[model samples]
Target: MNNLDLIVVGGGITGAGILREAVRNGFRTLLIEQKDFAWGTSSRSSKLVHGGLRYLKEGHFGLTRESVKERERLIREAPGLVEPLEFRLPVYERRKPGRWTMGLGLALYDLISWKWNHRYMPRNEFLQNVPQVDPRGLVGGFSFSDAQVDDARLVMRLIKDAEMNGGKALNYTRVNKLLRNSSGKIEGVVTEDVETGEIKPFHAPCVINATGVWAENLHPSPEKNKHIRPLRGSHLIFPWELIPITTTVSFFNAQDGRALFAIPWEGSVLVGTTDIDHGNSLTDEPRITQGEAEYLINSLNHTFPGLKLSLNQAVSSFAGVRPVVSEGNVSADKESRDHVIWKDKGLVTVTGGKLTTFRVLAYDTLKACLDMLPHCNLDAISEPVFESRRSITLSHTVSETVLRSLWGRYGKETLTLLNESDEQDLETIPGTRTLWAEIKYAAKYEKIRHLDDLLLRRVRIGLLLSKGGKDYVGRIRSLCENVLPWDNERWELELKTYFMLWDSCYSPDAFQNFSR
Candidate 1:
């Protein structure tokens, strides 16, 4: 690491992808994250490896095609990470798009991804809605193929792959300054470990600035604020038994045409996602607004008359900003999902683009950066070593029916996850598979410091469980007692600090009066 060829300044998907690609290319690389990996938008995504079916409405055919093909690659390259999910959109006369129109759109979507029509997923078709949702007054629905993935886990796996290929990653490390030579060319950066408060200077020939919403913070300009708009999109998680739709439910907001989704996740039902133009940085945690919660409940009620969900029913909720490139619209949801890469001197900044196409974005970024490289046998390199047969996991398990279910989310890594532990490691935590093993693994391997980092990103119990992981503070503290080197007083203080951090998500008055 003394002499580095490249340095990436973010641990999000983009940064992780760049580092992975760079290392595979045999570049001496250093990747540093201010907090934990996927601490920003990468962890806060809708958890879908999708092709942007809704974007097709806006005539974004190219985006859809690219996403579909990239999705195919993900299922192949990372079987344990990317999984196929069937999405069902119930067609009602009240809805604008009729059965035929929706069917035609899906058929075209199938055509775009015809290469793998038989291997991975089925083509879009009509199916009977699950009995949970009232099928009354419902026309035929359109079902299509997409994939679901654990965002944080995928980011971790990418970093793991990069590490396996000789890349240096430092968590709790902050890049305070971007260095440039006298010739006005970007060269390296100034970084510091937040815990040690130690500063260090690192040099790299090429730098990719994939800090998502924090791009402007690294290299700000007069128009940086206008360049990126941070939108706060929120979601509420509930017990899976409550949601009637077994398949991923694709429903539109009756009041507005915005797309909303309800997917099934680890023994719990996933419901969310109300997009608004406002936002807060990654440092400050965000919460779902009352209006947003009410809208979600009403969407469920309207689509499924038998079901009733109150705010109290919401086990937990989360909110994060989407760093979409500004497209003349103040509304974040209206902004284009396309990505933009900018190179000033030797620094390359990539912002925007959907989650499903991250690898492709990385490939494009690496090829472009190498092409722009002064000269280093760039053309001599043949193909990348990204694809490997090392992946090893399947959903088949002898435990409970839930084992198969959990394996789907965990992937080939699930086998390693299970084999790494004995009887003690099998103990599960709150919010689905928030096991003690996972907590330890996050610290030992995945770079976790504070309880917030574990609950929010590593385990996701913080967002999907009530009390924002306050219920599991004892579990974490007990582990800190045995495994982590901390005093009882320190453990108690960590628990308290975590609660206060969780409280920052919502206004004091809002949470105090926020009863169902």
Candidate 2:
């Protein structure tokens, strides 16, 4: 711990992946996050692990191929986190891309994946599989394979894996400035513990600035802002019954030619993701604009004419800014998803890229620094280790359904989660598949410094539940009362802070009559 070969700035998935890769490559590493891990775009993605079917249209074949390989690898290596999801892309009579065109794209997708599982479904079979789609102009659909994931959980698991491989992680630690040698080459960082007003210095031969949308803050350049554009993507969550569908429904927005999806996840349906340029400060939490919500709702209603969906039906919502590499004066959505890595003043800054290809991005980041860091050994890169315990364990009785969910999420730590729980903890939270044990385990082992860190990120009850988990606030408080060492006054304050964030950042009401 005293001497380090590399230091990672940011606790996001990108930083976590770098730390994991660095440790596996025999480097002594440390990772520091200004907030909690996955507290930014990593936690707020559309939660898909796919080959970017849309990217194929833009001639991003290499990106799509890499993503397909990684998506398949994650489904195999992290079975508990990355899960296969079926997608139905319904093509209407007047749709931009006709049925045949869409079918050809699906074929190419399947070909690149080499799994050959996609199919073109006729009207009858399509309606049978997805009864919710409007039959008005439905001209059949294309079914393809993809994957869904708990983005935040995957990031936390990577951090856990990095720690298991001898990498050090410190949450609630802010890197105020980069440290430099006499020649002004970056060497380390000066960090401040957010919990307390204490400053400390750490030294390392190399430092990585994997701060996503906030990357420019670490090593600012005259053209840094020109290189990276923050594109905001928002999603609205609804009760599964409201928009019941066993498979994801993909369609283009009638008003604009943007892609949108209604995905089934975590016992609920998530309809999301509008990509638009965000001109707001990176420090502020991204809130879904009312316009964005209305746009998604309109897309859903147009696709399922009978549904008559509205903003009121949305249980909650979320927004994240994607760090997209700018591609001239094009639209935000047209910006390249490919990540860029470069060294400036000895600081390796990594920005852009999709969530599904984080591992490749991490390896690329390290490879970018190989010349500058001759002492680092890339040959030592080892295969990921999946089974290992990082938390304490206890005894309990739980159902097989709940057991499998825990195993998929916790991996080797599922035993610890079960041991940490009793019968009461095994009960599922009302309206959610999540159990009370998840909240307890997160509070105990996930380094939850804030209430939202536990409810929103660690367990996602805040985003999945109606009213952002407000109804179960008392129950959750009771469950984590002993685990988190906070006084009654502190608990009240944390509750107030969490609710403010939930109402403003995780619900549609936050955008009612509000402007950016």
Candidate 3:
């Protein structure tokens, strides 16, 4: 038996962060993710590491402060991936929260977050005069800041950092069961490689389950461990030029407290997130039902008053499963977003958290795990999460915020794709929204063993565009032949698999579901 200090299950941001810290502290760390890193809800997030902008409205100020601090830290530390995002809230008639109320809400959001916070971005108030805000029903707009993150990129960087240290990380592998000793302490478990279907046994004293929605599979029932009510948040990407709001626009869903964003990603506008209750079955692809798409489209139209973001202009769509803690609320939207890390006899199961607070959650988990082990060092370090000078230099590499955006989230890890993409032409991958080198690099350093992993999680090629294209997938399939040793038959299968998953998860309406 190869005994170790810890084994982390789940390779989302939280698990990856803990893996990075554990290995840095010299713990013999092993992180096993059942699928590609961030393939679960982590990749499907609104892709922001914001201070709890909504939490402030709900008066969760403590959570906001911690999230704000972590957001800044991540932006500074991982320049290439996590970057500051400014959001403009356009006041419209009959919106749930009126302008005065929202103004108060945002002012409070800035008050706690701005405290001791370095000037990563200008304060929200300065952007009020910016003409980039849609001057439509946007009577008056209040601007605030959060973060825009390449959720998958950030997770990959963390995994790389962990590997850069001594931590061992295995993806596309599932943890079958938790090992137990005579005293019922967690001793690790059996794992199976997804590609080869080979099972292997490993041992560790502590096992952290960060498996997100799929976690219920690890235990007999999630109710037996902690409660996780799976909620699906779906997003729609539209052509960038249509209502190209330079800043993210947040509108209160008149139907519910759920919010929406018309924020820029890559070159398009991302409008999303309908919170609906989901279930036990977990799949890489979940289709967007007609009702959900209509709801989102209608909501955006209502917010912008006439952006014409109908199915005709829809480019792409994506969905995520949020494993929110079941707090006796019939509504998934009302479920608490706070996280809980509890020991179940021996297994340390982590549940219920958001993107903004992933770092603090990881730090707290490290402290608790180390305290459980007397000899392990959980010593706090004074190193700021990011280097300020490097952050500034990187952002200036492209435009007002390109390099800073890349370097902040990736740190030194940005070099992986930067070297490749820099040399290549700025061409979108055939059939997808991704640049060519990104997919090329994914095949290289990212260890994208399969196309589904590359298209969905590695490069977000298929998900970023408004119209999902079968033609583009075929083109990528041909390009991939230059890198992967797939036979023509296997190439077709990978191409079909990627589209099938997308279609299944987003609905089979062919026209509505196929392209955008």
Instruction: Quote each prediction's TM-score.
Output: 0.87, 0.95, 0.86
Q: Residue 417 of candidate 3: its Cα lDDT? A: 50
lDDT of each: 0.70, 0.85, 0.70
lDDT of 3 by residue, 410-514 (tens): 456555556545444345554334556566666766768777788778777666553345556655665566778789798778777766666656432433544
- On residues 20-83, what C-alpha lDDT tens digit does candidate 2 reach at each position? 8888887888999999999989999999999999899888999999999999988887766788
Give Cα distance to truth, residue 353, candidate 1, Å.
1.2
Measure candidate 2: CA RMSD.
2.3
lDDT tens digits, residue span 1-516, model 1: 678888888899888877877777677888999888888788877889878877787788898899998888777655545768877777776667766777777777788887433221222233344555546656666657688888987787778778876898988899988888899787789999898999998888778888888787776533454477777777777777667567888777777767788888755777768777754445655566777778888887776677777767766666667877784645556567887788778888887776788877776777667754544443313342234443445333335543543344343445666666445756666447556666665655555677777777777777666677665666666554555666778667767777776665632123433342
Candidate 3: list runs displaced more than 4 Å: 93-95, 115-139, 220-226, 371-374, 386-410, 413-422, 426-434, 466-469, 473-479, 506-516
lDDT of 1: 0.70
Give the best candidate by TM-score. Answer: 2
Q: Rank the candidates by TM-score, best first.
A: 2, 1, 3
Clashes of each: 4, 3, 34
